[model samples]
Target chain A: MNIYLRLVYRNIRANLDRASLFFELIFPLFFIFVQGFGLNGIVPPFDVGNGRVISYSLFLAAGAVTLTVINGGTNAGTQLWFDRKNGMFEQLLMGPFTRAQYILSIIFATLIIGVAGSLLVFGFAFPVLGASFAPTWEGALLIAGALFLGTMFFGAFAIALSVVLKSSETFQIVSTFAFFIFLFTSSVFFPASAAPSAIQAASLANPLTYTTDIFRAGLFNAVTPTVSLELGVLAIEAVAMFVIAVFAFRRIRV
Target chain B: MLMAPDQVVRVDELSRHFGDKIAVDRVSFDIARSEVFGFLGPNGAGKTTTIKMLTTLLPSTSGRATVLGHDLKTEGRKIRAQIGVVQQQDSFDQGLNVETSMDLYGLIWNVPKAERRRRIDELIGHFEMQEFRKMPTVDLSAGQRRRLQVAREFIHDMDLLFLDEPTVGLDPIVRRSVLDYLKERVRQGLTIFFTTHILEEAEYLCNRIAVINQGRIVQIDTPENLKRRFGSAKAVEFKLLQGTSSEMASALSSSASVSRFGRDEGSGAYRVTTTRPESVIPEIYRLADRLNLTVSSIYISETTLEDAFINLVTEDEKAVANGGRAS
Candidate 1:
């Protein structure tokens, strides 16, 4: 287990150049600002019970943070595809560790990056959008929980697809498809009620929807649907995906 | 004779097949404690496949194997704890600097912070990596990266080590230094299993070698014994005086001293194979003197490992060809 942790640490440290604050965090932060504040004039306001200008910017900010987790997890798994092509995966597989350990290390590193990126986005979003965070410490815990479980679920899914896919190009295609699916189907852009009945049903089935729903609830203390329902859905998805990913990785032929 | 229980590695009929293609066929060998065993073979000869099995990377298709007496299938994690591996390719984390890279590997092995720091410092100097210790691995040269790969494996005192073509693609001086370092570790009781196609490396480093071809072990013996058994005997070649007839070649072939004689098809030169070339040379000179044939040039060829390898492989090929023809 210590070896596995060390491996995770090494991957994060080694990839520092690829982890530029400007590109990954700052750029996404700016995009969230433009989508939130800049679009308020052209885009019509969302109707809430009170006649206050509904800050879609805050909603978009939270969505961006969730998207960052998805991006981080997908990129981490795709990097393994590059390693496999270069024979580095073969080398690691032949080393002392089991395949399960290898996958865990990758997932751990992705989780760190995802959570860190999400937190940074949260810090930037709070000030720019003038959106107040939950005053209670429970909100912070919920945010952390969302990042941790969400990244692991997506990270495991990416790893499973990576082992089955033949090349990075294919992984990229699948990732793009997954991103759009999660982005549109989940509560990233709009509330589940705004979607069609069929779309809402599909969104409820998506693990990302539950994760995003819970995170939004924690940030705004606004419950669109039952908060517990989304949390429960995410928990089951996280556990099931983790098991499948570990098993799929173990059965992979070096 | 009773074998000791402390053998570093024991393989029994280890085979791995990919679908219908048998990549590693029923190959079995063992390494005694502190011995440097060389797995020598040409490309596509199952060296990597066998190494993968030994290192617990791939499951064997049949048979049983163990490392440090722990079953490869059951106790892989424990076996992994007791061994170090240097793969053929450089696999250092490209995102980390050399120091961080080593630190992470040490951390994974659960080394204490103080011990890890001391070992990192010692290894930096020992591997001549002090200058590049702060530089990311992506910035290092091939040789520098290879040094880090080898150094990373030595952070812990492992009982067994696997080096898969560790020195492939390095200059002669660097290759020698790496091999020497491995030998030094072997002297300190580290059992090493390394794969290489360089025969001279096997000759200099290995206590015993297994020559593999087409997924099978063609021969397994000490270098000296293999040289003696399959190595070519001395041979003498002479250019016959212009117009030396085919009849003369036939006559020379029947000589008691000459095992076989043939003429070069293009040059019409006479080549003689003999067990005792020193005595046979005198006989050839005498025959030439009586026949009044002028010898234009004479050359003798010495035996080498390359000759022994070619002879062994060709002998097998010849037997296969003959069987095919008979069938």
Candidate 2:
């Protein structure tokens, strides 16, 4: 096998434990079932920004799929922290692969997990949530684009953060704080359109909002020009984050 | 720059500084094929830093080096592909069992599957890891972890292998086994760059040893040459069948040949360090006779590499304190 492929396989194999399983699959399922069901009766159906309306479970299922992407990216980036602690970071760099290949393998592995997790959530929702499933070619492309761009952006951002932070304690604290802040400020749990003006403005400023918007729109076959516009903005953010990650990684001492 | 055909590593005045602190200063050396070159030093003595720079894990602040005929700066990837390094720090996947970890390391080196399986079995047996082969690496004892770490490095082929304190934490028997294993590899034409604080280990395995102090190379020579040059003072000791009087102590202490003298607390033997043990031994006999003390036994002990190493490093420290370079 190629060096990059070997590294990717190593990353995936090393991370396939119970803790990662909880974050990648079980955690998202909790949000989709418990939270989605608890609020189903009190909260009315959601418009989903298209003419058709959907149940609360169906609406939150899309957001839950996105939760998998976030978790996958976080796991991918924290892998670096673990490798550094265990001395594998220097060991791998001194192996056959270049620095670029090592970083790209990590990002690529997260992308694979993110897309697979999202598809699994989508499959679960189709039979369980009683949601309709039909889409144009463009709708499917928009969902694919959202998963790819969003995973890349978060993977790179977390990697950059891990490289800049000195200790694992600080990394965990900052990452958790950032996760909750991004979760509340974005359209992951609720519609930014229905939120107050302050939250809506903050949501608009978050790149994750654009990702969530594209994903939700595509899930309901509600493709619009705005979804494409959101995809464009996400692509730019992903590229920028990737550049920062590479720059920070190059400056690392070991 | 092209190295000689026999040279696997060639370092030229390489240095690394962290801000104002120099971690590795202007170090230069060469390792020929099939030679086990030992780097012996005390703690925090730039041994690991030098290994890191030579292994392509860290860049030097100045100067140059070539590993396997590839430049350290521009050709790090090429150099890395042909070399193996077992670092001082422990590195392995905690989630994987010992056998799996070895297999994964083989995979990283691009060793074929069938060969990886064959080597895994061989290493597990050779390193005596069968008792814990199925145990997770995180749960293994420090010695077991170290054995696995060293054993896994043999799974792949490399022209030059760098081992930074590889035998640390091993029991004496296991340490000897590991050293013997390395000797077998050396016989098969593998060049080794070994670092350790164990003087006996260096004396046993190294064809030539380099002693580093304060980020500088203090001395580099064969172990025998090192002992001959710096450890020339032999220890002369004589045990008295009868207790000694004050006169006998005074006579031995005032002798011209004996420079340092002390009594062994357990054996009641008078020990003296002298440049000329032959003269000192005869003088000790005369003093014993005049003092009416019976001399039971007398012998001259040989100097060791540990004595030479301490002598060199102590002299270097004293020279630095006096603002002079060590000779």
Candidate 3:
């Protein structure tokens, strides 16, 4: 077996804990169920500025899928923190592999986790929430591309983060901070049109908003403005994060 | 044997710096194949820093080193592939059990499956970890975990092994077992770079020992030669029935063989450090009898490795105090 593959497998398997399950599966599903049933039609009907009346649950489910991408990236970055606390970093640095290879393994493993997790949430949402949704070929392609690029972008960000942060408490703060900021700015709970002007502006610049747009367009068959532009931006961000992560990892002491 | 002359590790003027402070000075040495080279010093004596630099774990600030003829800087991966290290701290995959940890380590080192199983079984038995083979490594006792840590490295074949205080928290029997295990490996043509602050273990195991102090190699010689170089006086002890008196102090000070005399505060016994204990013993007896001092006990002891160790470190400290250092 390839050493890098073995390392990645070990990391992913090690992350199989109740907390990971709750964060990736149960936590998002809880939001989906509560919003899907509790607010399906109870509130006054409101239309987005574009004359599209989007349901709250569908919007939340799309956002929840993208949440998995962010979760996967942060979790992957924290794997290095655990390894450092346990002295495995020193042991591995002295082994046969280079530091870059070790960092890459974590990134790849987290990418797998993010993609699989988003797929799980996306596929299971229809039967669980009773939402009648199916994908056209173009919709499916955009969703897959967005999830892939978003996972890579966040995975790279997490690796670069793990390289600089020292304590787990601080890392938790940073990850939680990033997650909530991205969650609120993106169209997770409501369409950007329903949010205030400030949040709408924030969403315009947030990479996650573009990812959520791609997800929403595919899952609910909604029309996204300039779909190709979103794909290009996501691709560019993913490439930039990967290159920076690889560059920053070299400065970390053994 | 020291004469094997294979020179598996050759370090020249190696040094490491953390910020402005130098952790390891310009230290140089060589290790032959199949020899147990012990590095002895106290904590913070640069033993670990030097080991880290030589193992290619930490880059040196200034130096030239070659492990297996591969340069330390450019060929680190090649060197790492051929060497193994057991660091001072305990490291294990907490999620894996003892047996699985061994298997995974062997697997990471790219050992074949058949050989991995064979070595795992052999190491488990050899380290007396059979009962805890199925237990999680994080839950094992410190000594048991250490056994596993040291034994797991043997899963891979290597030309050189670096052990940094491998028996720090072990019992006497386990420590001896670890030493003997290392001895057997040395006999099988494995060169070991062992660091320990324990003088007795160094004496029992090392063929040639290097005494490091304040980030410098103060002395490098056989255990016997180290004692000969740093040791010149033996201890002669005398216990009197009563507390020490002015008369006994005067006699010891005027004796020809005795150079230093003092009463131990704890035992109230007297110690006379002398160059010639044979003549000093008779002189002590004659003085005690003449003064009507009831001598309870008297004994002459040779210099020990511990004594030699303390002396060497003290000399280096004094030299530093006097602003003298080795080139």
Task: Please report the candidate that would top TM-score against the real structure.
Answer: 2
Residue-by-residue lDDT tens digits, candidate 2, B117-163: 99999999899999999999899999999999999999999988899
TM-score of chain A of 3: 0.88
Question: Which has the higher lDDT value, candidate number 1 or candidate number 2?
Answer: 2
Taking all chains together, the TM-score of candidate 2 against the true structure is 0.93
lDDT for B205 in candidate 2 is: 96
Give the candidates in order of TM-score, highest first.
2, 3, 1
lDDT at position A164, candidate 2: 89
Error of 2 at A232 (Å): 1.2
How do the residues A1-254 of candidate 2 rate in per-residue lDDT, one tens digit apiece? 87788988888776456676556687778888899999989889867766868888778888888877887778777788888888888888888889999999899888888889888877876578777778778778888999999999988988999998999889888887887787888888889888999999989778789888898888788766688788888999999999999999898887
Q: Judged by DockQ cut-offs, is candidate 2 incorrect, acceptable, medium or high? A: medium
Model 3 C-alpha lDDT per residue in residues B147-259, reported as the tens digit of each score: 99999999999999999999888899988988998999999999999998788899999999998888888889999988877876998888988777789898788877788
Flag the better candidate by TM-score, 2 or 3: 2
- What is the DockQ for all candidates, taken in turn? 0.45, 0.66, 0.45
lDDT of 3 by residue, A1-254 (tens): 89888778777655345466566776677778886668867755444323546666666777878888888888777777777776777887888988878888888888888888888877887567666755689878888888888888888888788777778788889878987898898877777767899999998877788788887776666655777787888889889989998887777776
Using lDDT, rank the candidates from best to worst. 2, 3, 1
* TM agreement with the true structure for every prediction: 0.85, 0.93, 0.87
In the range A1-254, model 1's lDDT, one tens digit per residue, is 46677667755655445645347677567758776677756666564222223567766677778877787778577657756764557656655577767777888888888888888888877786776544557656667778888998988888888888877788889877987888788877777778899889989788778778678767665554466676777878888988988877776666
Q: All candidates' lDDT scores?
A: 0.77, 0.87, 0.83
Q: Which candidate number would show the highest lDDT if scored against the true structure?
A: 2
